[model samples]
Every structure is written in C-alpha cells, then in structure tokens.
Target: MAQRILIAEDNDRVAAFVEALLRHEGYTTERTADGIETLQRIGRSVPDLLLLDLRLPRLHGVDLLKKLRKSPVGNDLPVIIVTGVYRGERYARAAQSLGVRHYLEKPFSANALLAAVKDMLPSCVQVDAAPEEGEPFDRHLYQAFSTGFSGTFHFEGKRKATLSFIAGTPVSLRPGFRHRDFGDYLLQNGRISANEYDYYQGAGHFRSDVLVQLGCLRYPELLQEKLAYLTGELLEAFSGPPLKVEQRSFPLSPGLQLFTLNMPSLFHRGYWRSSAPDTANPFPEEVYGQFVAPAAAFYRHVNFLDLNEEERRFVSQLDGSRTMAACLEGASGITPLLRLLKTFGMLVFAHEPLSVEMPAGMPLRLLFNVLEDETGPGGDGPLESFSDLVNEESRDDEPLLPAEPPPVLPEIGDLSLRVRQVFEGMQGKNYYQIFAMEQGKFSFDQLKTHYFKLTREFGPETMMQLAGEEAGMVEDILATVTTAYNTLSDVIKKERYDELLGSEKVGLGQKGDDIFQAQVQFQSGKVFLDMEEWDNAEKALQDACNIAPKNGDYLAHLAWSIYRNPQHGSSPAMREKVRQTLNRALTLDRVPSAYAFKGWILLEGGQDLLAEAEFSKALKLDARNNLARKGLREITEKREQEKKGLFRRMFS
Candidate 1:
C-alpha cells in the first residue's frame, strides 16, 4: 500500500516542490503552509510521516515537534526537519530528544529527502537470510541486527531455519527444538566415557539423559529411568500446562546460529519450580554439577572482609543443596545475595533456578558504588570511600586491605561568610549579565565596554580575588565569567583584565578606538556571512578566520558561500578554498552541521561513497542531526532504487 506523507512547510514554493516529488513517487501527500495547519491536519488523520520546517508561522518547528511527540499518533511517526537557520548543539539535542529522524538544511537534494523516508519506514529489513535447515548455528550473523526476543522453539525435522521480525510482529514458525537428544549426540561424538557417565549419575545425581550420553547406561535404560522419575514428580510440577517453548533464531556467526527460548508463560512470572514436586529438582542434576563446584570454589577464594558483613554471612550460609529462595529465607533477605552474585558475573537466570560459577573478579560492585556515590543523594562525599577502596585494591605488592579515609578540612567561619556573600551577589547573573550584555549575541566592543565599566568600579585585583575565592561556590560564577571573557576579549582573564579593565574608565576612554575598530571588523564579518554577499562574506570570513584561525565554522561557511556563486562553483580555486575551510571546520568542531555540509559537497562532486561515509560520520557524532539524516536517507534510497535490470541499463 502507498504510504501517506505530510509536508509541513511554511514556504509555499518548498511545499509545492516536495508535494510534486512525493506525488511522482506514487505516495499520497498532504501539505500545510504553517505549523497551525500542520497540527490540525495531523490531529484529523495522522500521516505515516511528517516533513517539518524549523521556522514556521503561528508555531515554531521545535515547539510543534514536542507537541507531536506527546500526541498518541505522532509519538512514533517519523519526522524530517527542514531549516535554513544554523541550529547549534542545544537545538539539535532538543530535536533528537523529541525523536526527529532526519534533518535537511537549506539546499538539500531530492535524493536526500527520499533516502530519509526509506530509512525510517517500518517495512525496512536489513539483515541477511537465516541459515538453511541442518546448517550449523552461526554466531556472527545473529549479532548483526539489533533485536529483542524471549522464547524457545522445537524443530520437528533435522533442518535449521532463520527467523526475523521487528518488534510487535507475529511469529508462528518453529525454528528449533529442545530435547534430551543432546546426550545421544554427545555419545555419538565420543566426548564422554560410559563409566564416567555412571559415576556422574550415582554420585553427582545427574539427569538420566546426561548419564546415558556419558555412557553410564544405554539410551533405552536411561529413557525408562527418566519415565519412572517423571511418573512420580513431573506430572505434579508441570501440571499447570504443557511447556510451550517458543524459539527465535538470531545469526551468531557465518554458519553458527544461536536461539532464544521462551518457555511456558508460567516461567515468565519468575517461578522456576512448583510446590507439589518440591523434592523434584527444578533443573537437571548434571546442570547443577556443572556450575556448583566452580561456585563453591569462588566462594572459598572470595575475601569476606572486602564484602560487607551482610554479604559475608550470606555467602557463608550457602550450601550446594539450598535454592536461591531458600538461601534468601535463611539469610533473611535476597537483596545482598542477588547483588553480590550478579556483580561478580557469577550468576545467570534462565528457565531453571539461577546458576552461579566462579568468574574472573568483576569489581562491578565497587564501580557501581563509586558511580552511585558520585551521582546519588549524598553527592561527592559517597565517592570518597569508593576512591579509597579502589586505591587499596590497586596496590599489587601488599595484601589488599581497607583504605584509610582522608582527613576532613577544618571549617572556616569568616572565609565561608565571604564566599557566601560573593555567591549571593553573582548567583543570578551569568557572565554576559555580569558585564551588562545579552548572552550569546554580543560584539567584542560591547563586551569590552561592559568589562571596563565593571572592572573600573570593582578594581581588577579585587574582582579577580572575588572570582578566585568563590571558585568553589556551587553556583558556577567563575566559569560563567571566564566563558564570557573568553568569548569577548579572546584573551585570558589575567591578561585581559590587567591590560584593559585594570585601568580607570576615564583614562581608557581615548583608548576605545582601536578596540572599537577591531570589534567593528569582527561584527561586520558575521553580518556579511548572514547577508550571503560572497565578496563581503569572503572578506569578513577571512578576517574572522585570521583573528580566530582555530574557528572552523567561520572558515567553512565562508568557503561554502563563495562556492555557492555560479561563477566560482566549478573553479579549482573555489574547490581548494572549500577544502581548506572544511578541513579547518572539522578541526575546530567536527559537529554534525560541519559534516553534513562536507558530505553534501562530496555527494555533489560525484564522490557518493565518500559522501555516504561523511554523512554516516555526522550521524554518529550527533544522531539528531537533520542534515546527516537527509544525506543518509538520500544515499540509502538511491542505492535501493538503483536499477539492476537490462531495461534499466538500456534506458540509462
């Protein structure tokens, strides 16, 4: 069925262009010229996809995206964002949180639009086909696609098959089976001795099937023994329903397959064993033997003092015979046991009761505690003990022991009061506000003007002392002020304030011209780029680049605007300029926007593979990037639609 697409563009021309393109692809599209109509149209009948513009009439694109996510139908609906304005990290992060799938900057191609749509579609399947019946399970193939499944299945015949589906897709085919057949297969393969199998059954109390495979008994005798045991206990334990195991196959390797088993619904609620057959082991004794020895060995080697008293007592009480719940009951709580066991990687839960083995020392508990203390209610104080523990553990020459705590700092009453005073005065004001300028939008001249006025009143040394003394304040005043100064002066705090703000404003009045001229030139360059005049853009961008040679965006955009002109579009000089600009931009900040533009240029220059790689790189850097999404989508769709037939070749 043809999918319905909605284009919410504020510009009439852009909307018409998109509508025509989608129509040519046989998709029914709805168009809205503003955000208000876009929301209204979606509310009436949600489209499969939405093409949103960042700047729209009535409501902004960002606000609309938020509203769409909250709406029931729009929550999972894919959206492609289109914008002209340069959205930095803040906007990109917000769009990503709202689940914008693709972004298209100005001058995006039709192929980019189509590519994005195809990538986000529900029907897209990217994995290779599952191995045929009788083929060995492949581990590599299983991990290739991201999937979540829980089920067990039984295969009727000898063949192996593959299974694939997205979330919520109904699966009916049985891919594999679970049975006592493993023992027979092992015996046929000569991996175990019959005497060893008998010893395992007699002493280890292994399952009959396992004993049979180990050569303890013939298959017929093992089957009879299993039947007799089942007659007395299995009927009661499995009485609720026959075990219905569902299977899903995942590619684990080129030829190796791994299967996820979904046992009966009874197992889903965390019940491993039933009450009537309490004496009947929930898992095969052979399974218990495989894990129990290692588990005991691990317990013996573990240092009890390293664990809390509660954990020590819990481990000491665990005997091989006791189940996890029974051990928890004896210990009075399962929390510590579960935590310690899981932390060490010694435990795994499955259809049977939890199993444990001695594993490599994990120290995951210590790591978790450290991370928790750093982020938890007590803040950094909790991390002190964790840090000490780590230090103590790292010393190889000495036996591991608990670390001594650091000495607490003495409280300073008057100094604390002074710190409080500095913080309270500067608390609400950001660095820009401190200097009486708007945040984010300010010229060097405006910044300098504010800086001198404030410093003259406060005196440079006193101001520096205040900022330094209150550096430990939680309000982040020092950082804000430093950032503001860096943005404006392009000089370190010590130097800028000492040379400029240290002097009296009256004395500095005559000195403002040189500062003002530098500021004017810088501001004029920004204005030129915004206005899109190539000559002015080049001149201003060059000046900005020279002043802040490390600034990649300025270099990139200057080169980009220059190349946009038809006269310079194909010039070798233009290409070189753009290459240098892009290289610098990448160096300054390999931000999604920079990569998106670079990818677009590469794509236009017939470097499709390089363009795709760049786009992919951009997406990796910022998943919420609309430009990268558009580029990726364009490439993907074009590849998928590329003709392989003789008719296609002939037409081309």
Candidate 2:
C-alpha cells in the first residue's frame, strides 16, 4: 500500500507542486490551505507524515503543531516543517522540541522532500514480524533495547551478536559465532593487505594488539575504528531477512573500555546511505569549502582516532574559521574523503559569518525590509542579514531606535509615595498580580512579555529622578517584579509556586506574622540570586537581615549577595566585608553557608589551597552543600590542569 502524506500549505502553487511530486513518487497526498482544515482531516484519519507550512490561515503552524502533539496519534507521527517567513532560531528550537525531525524552507526540491520522508519513515517489515524469539527491529524497539539493556542477541543458526549498553544507548557491539576476526575484517575492508593480515595472524596476537606492538597503529584510535566498522556491519545485518533472536542479559564487568555512538545520528546516516548509495552531496557547491567537522566528534567520541593520515591532517587544519574550500585546496583525492566523512555524520556544512558593516543610520523598518527582500523565497539571505544586524547593533556604541516609539507609560503621581505604598503592601501581592496576569491562566511567553514591559517601565535607571525614600521604594518594586519573574518563568519553580498558592487558598491567611514576612523576603532574595539579579538580590537579602537582625543564616546570605554585587565598590573592600560578615555568622553558629561564602572569598583572592580547606570544612558541617562541593571540584580540576602543564614542560 502507498504511504499517505498531508501537505498543509496556504500557497496553491506550492501545494500543487508538492502533491504532484509525492504522487509521482507513488504516495497518496492530501492537501489543505490552512491549519484548521489540516487538523480536521487529521482528526478523521492520521497521515503517515505531515508536511506543514508555518504561515497558515485560521491557525498558525506552530500553534497547530502544539495542539497536534497533544493528540494520541500525533506523539510518534513524523512532521516535516515547511516554512518561508518563520526562519528564527526561536521557531526552529520550538519545532524541534515538539519533535519536528526535518525542516525545509519554501522552494525546497522534490528530491530533498522525498529523502526526508524516507529517512523519517524507513521501509521495514511490520511490527508483527516477530520471528519466534524477540520483537521486530523497529526504531521503537531499537531505542527501547539500546537505552538501558545489556545483552547478547542470538540470531538463527550460526549467527549471533553481543551488545553492551549504558542508559539505553549502544556502547559497543561485538560480533559472535560465525563473525570474522579483526584481521579478516580489516583485510575485507581493504584497510590491510592479505599478506599483512596473514603475518599479523601468525604473530599469535589480536590484530589490533599486534599492529600497536609493531608501531603500525595507535591502539586507542585503531580500537575505536574497529568498533565503528563492526557496528556498521551489525546494523547492515539487522536490515536483512528476518531471523529468530534470543536476548540474554548479564552484569557488565567494571573497568572495561566502552565506545559511545550517538545512535540517532548514526542510524540516520546509515539509512541515508542505504537509501541513496550513489546520491550526490546534499550541500550546495558554494559550501563545498566551508564545511567543518563537528567538534564533539573529536573531544567526545573516540571516532576521531579512525581518521587516516590525510584525513587527520585535514581535520586538524579545520580551526572553525577555515572552510573546506580553503583547507582542501589543491589536495589529492579530497572530494571522496570529504564525501565519506559526511556520510558518517562527521561534518556540519558551513558556519556563515555575520556581516558587521551595515549602512550607518539605517532605520529599523528599512533594515528589516532590506533583509526580507534579499532573503527571497529560500529565506537564507534574510536569516543571515538579521543575525548580522543583531550582531552589529549589539557591538555598536550608539543605540538604534525601532521603527516606532514605544507607548509612553503613565507618569507616576508622587512616585515615592506610590512606591512606598506598594512596598508596604507587597506581602498581599502574588506573582500573578505583579505581572498583571489573569489568575489561573497565563503562559510562560505571556509572563515573559509582561515582565520585560514592567522592567522597562519601572526599572531602577528609569527612576533616576526619585531619591531618598522614593528611590529605595522603586528598588523594592523592581526586586519584587524580578522575584515574580524568577519564580513564574521556571517550570519547577512555577509548579511549586502554584502548589503553594493552592495550599494558601485553602488555609487561613498568614501575612500577619513578622517572622513569616521576613521568611517571604528571604525567599524572594534567594529567587533573585538564582535569577542572577545581583543588585536586586543584595537589596532584598539586606532587607531580610534587617527584619531579623540576629538571624545568622540571613546575615551569611546577605554577605554572599553583597560579595556578588558588581556595584559594591572595590574588590578589596568587598572581600574584607564578606570575611567579616562570615566570621560574625560563624561566631553565632557554624552554618555551612558561612563556610561556603568564606571559601568563595578565598577562591576569588587566589587562595585555592585555603579555599579548598574552607570547602572541606563546609562539607564536614553539611555534606549536601553544593557550593562547597563545586568549590572543591574547581580546585581539583585546576590542580590537575597545572600538573598536566608541568609534566608537558618537563618532557619538552
């Protein structure tokens, strides 16, 4: 049966083009001009894949996607995002989070669309094709078994395989039963001559070990390459005829070396290769020289060891800035090597450098129009120019005004008095009220929008005219809003806040007590600290300390807050005050926060040894103190790096 695809596009031309292409490729295609009709069709029957356009009538594409993901059928269904206007990182990230695996801007080729469809939906035997031993090898089964299970899979007859896994990801796959040894495997792949393999076999040692002993290979790198080769072979076997598979699990021995393969990327690369053995490079000719290898492939994976002499040199020459064009210039047999490397998920084609020099005094609207016009249907030019515009404006000393002036905020009558009133009654206000949100209904995006507006309207710098008591009140309001945003913006914090709100609603009001008020202020300060609003955190913490003068915990937190404040004057003065405050807190009680803050102060002053000691003391008092643990880890890593440097110098 032919697979079905639903294309949701507003443009009639694009929809017709896509539908014709899919039908030509032996697929049944459905078309809709907007999100509402698409959703209605999907509600009646889910398509095998969804080809969705971002700009749609009745509902936006992203909004429709979010709604689709909530439905039972949409969870695992594939979606290919087709967009023209929506070329922002925020949109891309959102789509990815919603499980959009493929993205194609408007004017995408039929071949590109077909490749994406095949990749997302690999043609395999149905799930019901379990051959008497284990379930069929579908992506779900692959992911499920690989994620956390360690086992040997005994295939039919003389064929069997052993796989080790850590946390549902394949660490390594070792062949079993009728599988060839490393020497034979190497010879079969033409990595070694027949004579070389025979000679290594005669040495009475494993091929890799013998190669290392003879200085023919680096053991670490050669081992990684062997594993990758074996893994690729195993995956190829899985795509063959159905066989009985018996799985057995056993405890993994400690201290064994494991190779971590990004299964998802690896599988995708393998599938693409399988589907299009002779396919040309998907990247444009303009980017041939600009392609760069993923840095993670070097630092994180052992696969970097698999590079041959020329491949190694080529990779080493890629210093992020050097394009493939520049690096592979005049190199022999480079195109084939580049193609092979890309096929194995080793390369990210091109990093477009942003243009910094825009026409001076360009109006924001004209600038946007210029970018949109240049970008065209493919949207590449606009995306790059917009990024460049942002980069240039950020580095510019002068502020560029928007196309239109922002709405003027209503002037505060008796600003000081109003601020003082809000501060006094702040305990009665909830996070929702601070942002002027309707109770019980608001999204994170809504909260963020309102929070920024509130900051601009009543932020500290905007209150330069207010002084004395009024200035202090303005600062307090800023802190309160900052606290609200800090809590409401985070999922965990927001959930906890909602739970607390529910609890408070069911119980008697507790705003009457002084200690409770102080606790609330302290919590608000902690929120600010977490949000990295240093000045606001310091002010709020100081107020908390003032409310409870003898509270050692309050004093210790206040000291740390003051230490982190950039505007707290000279470093020397700040350090001295932090030390004195910590000492006073320690005198009152041996709290871990005091010790941790002391460690921070010591660390900042280049006293690592002393800082380590302070952190140790804090850990002794409270083992769960993260600051103490983090401080110790930093000191240890620094010492290790220093020792490594010393050894390198001595050897040189």
Q: Which candidate comes out best when scored by lDDT?
A: 2
In terms of lDDT, model 2 sits at 0.60
Worst 10 residues of 2 by lDDT: 365-374
Off by over 4 Å in 2: 1-141, 144-146, 157-159, 166-179, 190-207, 214-216, 252-259, 276-652
lDDT of 1 at 68: 79
What lDDT score belongs to each candidate, Candidate 1 first?
Answer: 0.49, 0.60
TM-score of 2: 0.24
Q: On residues 1-652, what C-alpha lDDT tens digit does candidate 2 reach at each position? A: 4566788887777887787677667565667776776887687567778999865766667768878878897767789998765455555665677788787876778889989988876632256753444332434225433345565555553234555455455544545221355665565444556666777778745546776665544444355455556555545543333345666666756555343554443443433322332234444677765645443332223231222344444544443445667656544533434543543444555566322333355433222112122332344543232333344545475555556784354433334445555666664567897766766887778887876666555542235336555565555566557657877877898887787566432222555455676687789999998998998888788767655655778889988888888886444335545655666567557889888988987776555656878899999999999999999999888766754453333233
Per-residue CA lDDT of candidate 1, range 342-377, in tens? 333343333333333334565323221112223222
lDDT accuracy of residue 506 in candidate 1: 43
List RMSD in Å for every model shown.
25.9, 29.4
Error of 2 at 588 (Å): 76
Please, what's the RMSD in Å of model 2? Answer: 29.4
